[model samples]
Target: MKLFKLNKTNLNEVEQIPFKLEKDIQSLVEVNVESVFNLKFIQSELSVDKYRIDTLCFDEENNSFVIIEYKKGKSYSVIDQGYTYLQLLLNNKSDFLLVLSQYFNKVLRMEDVDWSQSRIIFVSPSFNSYQKDSVNFKGLPFELWEIKRYSNDTVVLNEHRSNSKESIETLNPTSNSTISQVSKEVKVVDEDFHLSKTNQPLVDKWNELKEEISNLDDVEITPKNDYISLMLNGKTLCYLIFRKNSISLEMNRGNVKPDGSRSKNYFDLDDPKKISKEGSWEWKSGTKGTIYKIPINKTTDLEYLMFLIKQKYKNLSN
Candidate 1:
């Protein structure tokens, strides 16, 4: 992609700055990990058994660990490497937790982490056609990001999206038992999973909201391990979490005050907003997070949910 600087009279083309080395790419990502991907950087050059991971990060959104690898120029199988790192985390969960505990100066317990959400992210200046094609499966827990730097001291990170309905489990029969089992454990959430997790009526209601959100231009539906995220322009606007009793939503907008009083349908915290506050999953909400609990026991609650969704959409689109 080409970037240009616009002045009053003309547009000046910005030159692409090539990465001097893989370390350069890794350093750029490490410094801006939180801003770019909302991942907390744990440590670089993390070695697990025989394989050395380029960067180890924590995903506070799903309460899982993410393994990021940077490739400058190499041909490798994204599927094999992705599953292998997931297998490593699944087999040795304690070690990964220890790294997180040590980095943040706190004790992390095994129960606090969600092992199923473990993922491997591959970052490079570019990828081969085969490398891109290998991760076309919708359920795979791998992310491919293309990073580039410009002469104007700007950087761009674009995530490669896949809409294929294929499942990686199709290849499990011929693969090792660990890969097969891990593949089953670390798959992304889908509509089928949502239907099974909630009743048909609730699923239909959520789908209604999804349809409205999907109608927006440049919007994408990303199924995460715990919630269904609605993203626009590569930024998550909000996410929907299905519970046994009600459907919970966390919006990504800030400066939203407490909406009246707390009710069964809606609730917003009254705490003062602070940028230093931690553990918020939304990219733009900062520390002041807003959550709405829409009761699924009644179908009429869908209208209220839609109102909230539209309000959030309007706030974020600006």
Candidate 2:
């Protein structure tokens, strides 16, 4: 994508800056990984057996490990490298947990991580059509991102989304054993997977809430393993969990006062029938803010829920 600077009604084209070294891209991304990918940066240059990972990160939202590889050349096969890295992680889980525990200065057990959600991310300035098409299979735990720097000191990172409807399992027989093994362990989750867990009435309610939430400004719905996250500006504004009868809406406690109490500026604090001050899965996953839970049963709940969500949208967007 081309970027232009507006100088008093005149458009000046911004020059693109090429990365001098692969390490340059790694450094920039490592320092800003949280803002860029909403991932916590672990150790860089992590070595597991014979393979060396460029940057290791933890996805708190998914409770999984993310392996990032930086590339400056376009000749390497992304499919091969992506599967190799994933296989390495599956084979050497203890090594990754050791690094994660040491980096966070805490002891994180094996059960604390969701291994099925693990993924590999390859970042480069550009990718060939073959590299792009290699990851086109649905439910493949691999992502390709293009990173570009500009003369205006602005940087852009864009993810390559696949349009294919085929699953990687279709070609597992012809592929190597490593591909089959990794495919069995890592699963890419989507909305349909979550929607399949509930009945049709709850599904309809979820769709209604999803559409209303997406209609809000700059809101993006991201489906995770356990919940559907509503994101604004790369930060999670709330989470929607599908239940047996109703969909639960979880949001961060936004209007807390200095004295450890919350104000009623955003949500209706008196409505215990709809809102609850209970701890949510996000709180258990080490998120730094308080999470509030609200249930959506019918159309009547949406007006109040969106009213609360709109306040959060305004706050986060500002």
Candidate 3:
């Protein structure tokens, strides 16, 4: 550095002076995590009862959360801090969970969602190869940014990211597994149901619903010969088996009435009335509101869907 003026006699001292290391590395990571991911960071102090954290980010879209910590010194056994944040997060889940579903968008529930699968990233300029190689990072979504001051007024930032371990069950693009075979002994539900094919409004409706619900999980627009089912939040809210223009409207909050009659009961939109929970949706003003208004098989509910899916996973997992 220009600050260190020395002759050849002291040249070795320059290398031993300890590089100052770029300081803006942490800020850059914060910028990307916030502006890119749309996360909010709340500043805090090590309060009387609880320790303080440097930064936290909420992924509202995925109902996933992320905690970030900066290490100015060496990596310590305190690495367990990230895990603690996750447990503390689940403890105060309500504050962050509800913020996920856009109340600004709509009052969808996020209680069924688990936020730990979010992520944790550590930023340090000097994460030695030893430290990086020694950490067992399995099953954790994380990243490391090693920043260095290269030349005059220039900095080098390297981002090493780990793939998210989060997995999902798509329509077994490679398996012969029938739903029946998957949930063989799992108290199967919707066994007699028909899958809805193309032109089914449920397909479109489910697509629209995805944007409205936050922290929504395992959403699959399941279609068979004549039925369409949306699997979300460990629950199959309802299913449709018809090709109706009823859902032409984008936003409809009340229940579409039965008897081909129109009433604002709101119960008409959901069935297996026990699972006929309250969920509101909105489309465009000029679109048709003719969404599918039929009940699913009585047995197919939230808990049951998880049972079936988990069961299916076991076979595939093995």
lDDT of 3 by residue, 157-274 (tens): 5655433332212323444343222222112112123313333445454444434432344455543223444554333444554433332111123333333444342223323334
Kindly list the per-residue Cα lDDT of model 2 for residues 1-318, writing each as its tens digit.
Answer: 889999999999999999999999999999999988889999899878988999999999788999999999998999988888999999999999999899889999999899999998889999999999888988888889999999999999888998798986777785558888887778889888888878788888777877887678778888899888888878778888887777787877654444556544344344545565655232443433456777777654776777777767776776
Question: In TM-score terms, which candidate is top?
Answer: 2
User: How many Å off is the CA of 102 in candidate 1?
Assistant: 1.6
Model 1 residue 299 CA deviation (Å) reads: 5.2
For each candidate, the alpha-carbon lDDT, in order, equals 0.74, 0.83, 0.43
Which candidate leads the pack in lDDT? 2
Global fold similarity of model 1 (TM-score): 0.78
In model 2, which runs have C-alpha deviations exceeding 4 angstroms? 174-176, 255-290, 298-304
lDDT of 1 by residue, 9-100 (tens): 89999999999999999998999899888899999999988889999999887888889999988677888888888988888888888888
Which parts of model 3 are misplaced by more than 4 Å? 1-28, 35-49, 95-109, 149-155, 161-318
| Candidate 3: residue 267 lDDT (0-100) | 28
Extract clashing residue pairs from model 1: none
> How big is the positional error of residue 151 in model 3, measured in Å on the Cα after superposition?
4.7
Rank order by lDDT, top first? 2, 1, 3
